[model samples]
Target: MDKEFTPRIAAILCQWCSYTGADLAGTSRLQYPTSIIAMKVMCSSRVDPVLLLKAYLSGSDGVLLGGCHPGDCHYEVGNYHTRRRFAILKAVFDTLGLESARLKLSWISASEGPKFAQVANDYTEEIKKMGENPSKKKMFL
Candidate 1:
């Protein structure tokens, strides 16, 4: 019997904003897919690009990066750094023949619980349409 396909998502969230937003989503009883696994980071800028690549290569169908809005990062320019890095990461994925759409970045404040839930649901659906990550079948040495 063939097992049903379910997209796996890795969410790297900023502790001050996105992670707190996710917590609010939970406390507010917002419903989202269980396919997402979230990790909290001190800042979005602290998330290495390699970690995002590794998540996809390791079988995550999609990766979600959430951070403070522009000009609102607690660390002053952290989100700016994240924006630049994400742009480069997308370019690298495209050059490698990977679908860059599998990666997403969103600005969510701690007060935006509804937005968090909406993003999660929407991104989950998008990933479902994209199917599984092709790299999952490849052997990387």
Candidate 2:
């Protein structure tokens, strides 16, 4: 891939799981795309739909949300809420003429460093094929 054409991915990760897993990936030196710009949150449920939209509008080619697996959330039902929210968000994306494939949700445990790296690589490649986010074509107020 051309260095200048690399996709820019904005990721929101739950601190208890996904963030820890990413930290582990870093400490372990697991190779993954550097295209990911990760932000840590207390829970996946805290990732507001508007935040994700803003990311794409701000020029991110893709947005990734990572959290604990179902029934494994540190906040009990947090991931469940995230699941529901993402479902709604996907619908909104479709209604807005956006490609739902540009957004991804993954469950990563604190012990899953390799998984985190793999997810990062896979999502980056997927975004590359999809090209830039169409939302960037419009100006956001």
Candidate 3:
């Protein structure tokens, strides 16, 4: 474990809120880890469990799913759907011998730039302490 390990995170953000919040974090010059690679989708519910699995299998040490808060989604109940789906995804991860801690679900409003940055930093540190994803090594086999 002496080798340098930088955790790679796949962040899927809702365009209406989470993405905007992340963008605002950047515009505000907030400091967060560079390990996250964010992808914006129309809504949090649009993210499929398969997509999250793919990210993990493809060498991502962690996956962060960000969406609007419940009752505040632009698409009414989209965030609710996301919350349910995320739970199922976590179960699937656990069944597959993957650490469910590697997956994070966060609700961030468009105005919560500081919160987004803090989440990013915290999640990044957690992943660093967790080390690399074991699934990554198995992917090549």
Candidate 4:
């Protein structure tokens, strides 16, 4: 088993919930992998599937989509929109032979800061096991 750790991860968090949770994580001083690069959006629905494509095309090893846990969207069902978009996005990744494991979509509320940290750590570990994204080399080379 050839295993190496590449910790570059792009964390796209909804301004409503996940972002708040991330803030709580900081206030609580919970330490997860610092590999996460956070990008905030007013709504998770605002995260276009194109961004995910662009991230992997650039240099991101993983793209983590976090939202308000389905119906809890502050924008009212914004998370639903995100969920549907990612469903198709994941399918596209599969069709292109890009490792779908590199993309993650999760529902975490503002109160669940510890959960947010755990998710970040868990996803990071998962992607680390998968190694670098194949799309990175395929697109660049």
Using lDDT as the measure, the top candidate is: 1
Model 1, C-alpha of 37: deviation from truth (Å)? 0.5
In candidate 3, which residue ranges exceed 4 Å CA deviation?
A: 1-3, 139-141
Q: Quote each prediction's TM-score.
A: 0.94, 0.92, 0.93, 0.92
Candidate 2 lDDT tens digits, 1-141? 444678889989999999999999999999999899999999999998788877877878999999999999998999999999999999998997778898899999999999999999999988888887766777653
| TM-score, cand. 2 vs. native | 0.92
Two-way lDDT contest, 1 vs 4, winner = 1
- By TM-score: ranked, best first: 1, 3, 2, 4
Ten-residue stretch with the least lDDT total in model 1: 1-10
Q: What is the C-alpha lDDT of each candidate?
A: 0.92, 0.91, 0.91, 0.87
All-Cα superposition RMSD per candidate: 1.7, 1.8, 1.6, 1.9
What C-alpha root-mean-square deviation, in Å, does candidate 2 show against the real structure? 1.8
Candidate 1 lDDT: 0.92
Steric overlap count per candidate: 0, 0, 0, 0
Best by TM-score: 1
**3-98, model 4: which lDDT tens digit per residue?**
546579999998879989998988999988888889899988998889888897786889998999877899888888889899999999799877
